[model samples]
Target: MGGKGHIFRKKLFQVGSEYKWLGNSGELKEITLEKRTGVTKELIEKRIKLVTTGIDYHLGHRNCEHFAYFVTGNMPRSDQSIWHMFTDHDPFNIQPMINNFDQLREALLRSKHCGPVGLSRGDFENAVFVSQLDDGYYTYHLSHPLGGQHLYITTVEKAKNFESSYNSIVLAYFGAFFGRGEIFSIVRQLRGC
Candidate 1:
């Protein structure tokens, strides 16, 4: 564990308190980020309550940037982790569940817009693919040969939830973090024909 994770997502929410310096010579710089939505003080407090038990910390995934972006909807990013992903990691294991999968593969191959996505990492190299089945409505799921939950990506709210779940699953299983890929993927998938 690194000391940088030293302060694992400390929540600082003093509205009128003075800024106390905590560095040798770190200069204070202020910049603005356009937010997707305004975050309420009540929401911030509620989220902060989840800082300990409800939040899982990961250098590559749920770093300070993600925490801020999630709460504020500003979507500020840390490129360091992503840079490391490209230079210091294995091939993007979109997972080989795509290969040698018989039952679900056949089923999805028959669907209108079926695709694939793995839910976890270790010992589950062969997971069901996330596919879309379209009739009048579209549905996204792993369509497991044995059955699993379908994550609907039709709305920003639902997509956000799926992104959170995907982040945890990918981090826990693939040993990698998605950063903002979850949101992008959801948006892209939602736009499918």
Candidate 2:
């Protein structure tokens, strides 16, 4: 590994098939739909073997981007490739408070992946009309018709921080890359989030 400035490549590719909320607001659902790569478990597993050989990476060739293409079959690419930003660890690096909740809603919608970046107190009753819970949390009142209504939950503290907060709602949901034993840090899955 490059020891912070150095880039690390996987000895092989690994992904899970579990269906969890892709982002705090299910951002990946939309992106995956737009994706046209068709793959199989067998193919992915086979490619996973290549990493153990330890090969050199070349730009637009045997690089990480190309490796992703081989594993995902999706024409590998990146969104924010500049990896030096430890900005996620500092809340101040993110747009402060966001002023009003209404502005937050607009920001959320305008967010890169239609996912939320952090928690803001808002009465977004559009999802489902549910009775407020005694603990301040509320549930969707399934009485109305189903419209892909879903809810995501996280601790109140993380809702207020960065790093983890990037995927909290959905501001450019890039999966943060991390090293072993690395602590509270930012992560992304390479192709921009």
Candidate 3:
């Protein structure tokens, strides 16, 4: 997959069932209304809240317009929407920084699937997120709410049967996809608390 570029399928994979924050406030709260209603609109609103607040807790929203505000130092027009930016731009080639991260993220949302390009499997209900990165193999986050996220960076040979708690995989082609310091900074900046 090296040189081929990362491919993010537009069809998002429902890795796990967990409650993510609603908005940029980093409040880490989930609205029960959406849960009870199970409406796509309500879910989309919840996603909007998460995007507007600029929280980095969800990997799927990392490359969003709000994420771009801090990364590129360019605030998008209020008239524009997160879906427009996130599902419109290409995120793979674009560096994963505050500046260009949004463009890349937008591209990801536009993709049929968003990821480093790899395969993942697990129990039907409890799925896992896995990615094969250049630097090391990683698990994005496990499905369901479980404490202590796990990342396994091992040899390619071992990667074939790679098993992890997370369902998000960071493919090797991305080149050390997830950086601890960068993510920490983004989370801290977005949280703004």
Stretches off by above 4 angstroms in model 1 are: 1-27, 32-37, 54-56, 73-144, 148-193
Candidate number that wins on TM-score, 2 or 3:
2
What is the TM-score of each predicted model, taking all chains together? 0.28, 0.22, 0.22
**How well does candidate 2 match the true structure in TM-score terms?**
0.22
| Candidate whose lDDT is highest | 1
On residues 17-116, what C-alpha lDDT tens digit does candidate 2 reach at each position?
4332355553543223234357886776666554333233333223454455556644344343433232232111122222233433354344332332
Ranking by lDDT: 1, 3, 2
Q: Which of candidates 1 and 2 reaches a greater TM-score?
A: 1
lDDT of 3: 0.32
User: Of the pair 1 and 3, which is ahead by lDDT?
Assistant: 1
**lDDT (C-alpha, whole model) for all candidates:** 0.35, 0.31, 0.32
lDDT of 3 by residue, 97-174 (tens): 332333324534343322342343442124333333343433233222332222222333233453432333332112
**What lDDT does candidate 2 reach at residue 138?**
24
Q: Least lDDT summed over 10 consecutive residues: which range in candidate 1?
A: 88-97
In order of listing, the candidates' clash counts read: 6, 14, 40
Alpha-carbon deviation at 47 in model 2, angstroms:
1.2
Candidate 2 has its poorest 10 consecutive residues by lDDT at: 183-192
